[model samples]
Target: MKIEDWFQTLRSKAETIEEKWSDATEQERLQLADQLFYLRQVSDTVVDLWLQFEERLSIAIRRIKQMEGQLPVDDKHTQVAVTNETSDKDSSQSEVASAPLKKGKESTSELKEANPYDPVFRRGEGFYHLRMFQDAKKCFEELMQHAPDWESGRLYYAYSLLFCEEQEHAFREFRLLSRSASSPTVVASSFNAIGCILAEEQQWLEAAQAFKSSLEIKTDQEEARYNLALCYLKDGDAQEALDEIEKCLQKDEDDWESQMLWLRAAQLLQSMDESAELAPPSPIQLPTRDLDTDTLQEMASLYESVGNYHRAQICYHFLTERLPREGWAWHGLAWNTWLIAGTKRALTLMKKAISLAPDQDDFTFSYGWMQLFDGKIDEAVRAFRQMLEKNRENRLGQSGMISAYEKMGEYAAAKRMAKEFTEDQEPYVRSLGYFHLGRLAVVEENWRMAEQYFQRTLPHISQLREVPIYMQLCASKLGEQTSVKELLQPEL
Candidate 1:
């Protein structure tokens, strides 16, 4: 059957089910709900696939735009022989495909080279976007055979697999990406996908954990948060479920899904309360206007420390209302914005913070990260450099510069910066330098060297989560017999 025919058939089936619903038996309606749920899941999964693929699509489109009029009369697509030698041949294909992976966007003129796989990707992506998952699966299978390492192709493949009901295969692909993808966005998306698969299997605890992990990697993903809330409800944590729903509502008060979840959570809580004889908590005065500035700041900082960014944001918002030009309040608010809304809006908020207090190293560093995640690598680098120039004692600035250098593929320059950091008088600063040096070594596939760097810094910076993570990653790569759980966390 043609892709259109099958898609239309599914639509026809849904229409028939809806038409019969008015007179259907309870059991029949349940069956219909199952079918509708499947369709809804497929739609949600494919939309996520397209969101991940959109970056590749935009890059491919830009490159094609730059290479206009240079195409051959016959733009024939051929399946290149898959082999170890393909790495060498990638240079002759799309320049974008061959470039070292980074989060930031590359300029089109810098990489306009064509590849046969680009055409295949466009075709697959087109089918994938149209809800023709079966045809999309075939196209992505071919793309995978051609370029197995491309995360975007793998994402589409996994998404199509889920729609095809190949749940096990989809889970494996998503799990792999979550564990090893270089980009945080890709890793977070993979974790969210894993959560969905686990949730479908009725493994509510595992699914909730996956969603939490996704949020830990990138807190601003609303879909993951919603899934986490649903999982909490399923896991019988009514109050926790309500908290997650409230966070979603904070983003969009009118969000129908969040409102529904909130209602469900409240009902669950009420049912539990009716059954249990719990004592009522003591009440306190609400929303006093006489709170001092320092008290408000402390409250915001305390909430921020506990991952209660919404509450922190509320306090910061109140502070901003009272102290319109205060950079500290704006800076705190900007960080929460990053956690709750992501880089697009956070970047603008951070710029306001930076402009108000050009002298605060904390604000400057925060602005640089906001810029970096927003894909403005050069601007982020400048912010980091400027902060370092203003005060050479600022270790965060040095670390930021090292990170930006690695993103830009300037390993030698990054190494130089790392070395300078190691020479810092402060042990904490030196630990950061060694930590970044370890990261650079890992990037170059020098597992043993990376392990040594990690070990040297572990005592000083083990408090920072990434130190143990890299140490475990290096240990695993060096053939050490260690539980891989420690790769993501220091413990189980």
Candidate 2:
């Protein structure tokens, strides 16, 4: 069937479903919900395919037009008539496309002649909107160098840096602009940018304050309000998040992100109400009005270390929500959730962490470990290899590679990696090397060699939980009950 016909059929189906939905019984409604969910997924897939086809079709048409340049005419009289007709049609179409840009450029030229600043700033804005970050950056940098006090140039320069992922430099520039910009709107925007940077660092409280400051300066700054709501959600204040998001929805009901956030906040609030025992304690009075970032981080770390995973989850959730761009926050949350929610859910969170910061060796190493635990040896191997390529000295990456190779039954590669790590300077690396070798020895049923390798590992990493387990197993195989008893002691 034609694409249009298929779409029309889907539309009719949707209309029928909608018509039935209002009159349906509760049981029927439940069944209809499942059908609707599946239908939405199918619709999304079809839309994506259609968009891809449209893009390809447009490119083909452009190529054909280029190839069919200057069509020949049968006679001179016919050529004249055809040329006149075609020229008029083509000129009209060309004029329509170029008119807005041409008029804009004319007005811009007049403004530039009347003003002291160069017209390149406006050109840079056009490039920025076109997503040409490098070109925009160059223009803004040149403008800033020539007119150092120009707030707009500095603001755009910082934005260009931000889009290009020079985050640290962008944060510094934004901070400077926040303090120095004479215009209130520019200062507010600078504050918003600063809040974004703080959020990227997982400083939720500080980010919220930054957004609040921006809102105070520019009351109608919708972006700041939305950001503040996100910060509230991160901080586990569901009611506050709901309230902020509701205000956004009130302003624009069709905003999909705000709608989603509103639902999330409402659900969270409902869950909190349903599980009274799981709710957090009331806030304690502090000497200061607000907690510092360092204090909040320390509390979160302490909770995680003490096995208070629920509390740790709250802290990490706040961090991740406030600083969605920060890979470490996501990784921390994944680890905390893994203790309670199991590997599969944690794996999804870990993947999000990896996507946000692919270059972070630690995040990549953890992702590989999770993949390994999920029995995805090939994927784990690829992740480990990628991490090792970025930082060859990454001990976790090397350890993951050894584990992945062992799981894949590539004993030779695993043994080679074990030998390489055993010779490394770091005690932890050497310990891991010995541990892998001991495991391999056990696999081979060489009890004596396994016991010896485990013994070697013990001196370097006596506190390691797995080391004692392997030591006891090897000793049991070697018919040494005394060593097993000693290794099994609680004090040991």
Best by TM-score: 1
What would the TM-scores of all predictions be?
Answer: 0.40, 0.39
- Where does candidate 2 have its weakest 10-residue lDDT segment? 100-109
Error of 1 at 233 (Å): 31
What is candidate 1's lDDT per residue for 1-492, written digit by digit as tens? 996897798889889989999999999999999999998897778666775687577666555754684443243431222111112321211111111111111011111135557667766766765657798899889988987766667777887787677979989988988887666666777787788777766788998899989899989867678778888887779889877878877786545445545555655564444222222112211223356676567657645544557766877888888897989889988899899999887777788888898888899999888788778998898999898888886778978988899999999999998998888887877777888899999999999999888777855542444665677677778888654244333223
> Which parts of model 2 have CA positions greater than 4 angstroms off?
1-292, 303-308, 482-485, 488-492
C-alpha lDDT of residue 37 in model 1: 96
The most accurate candidate by lDDT is 1
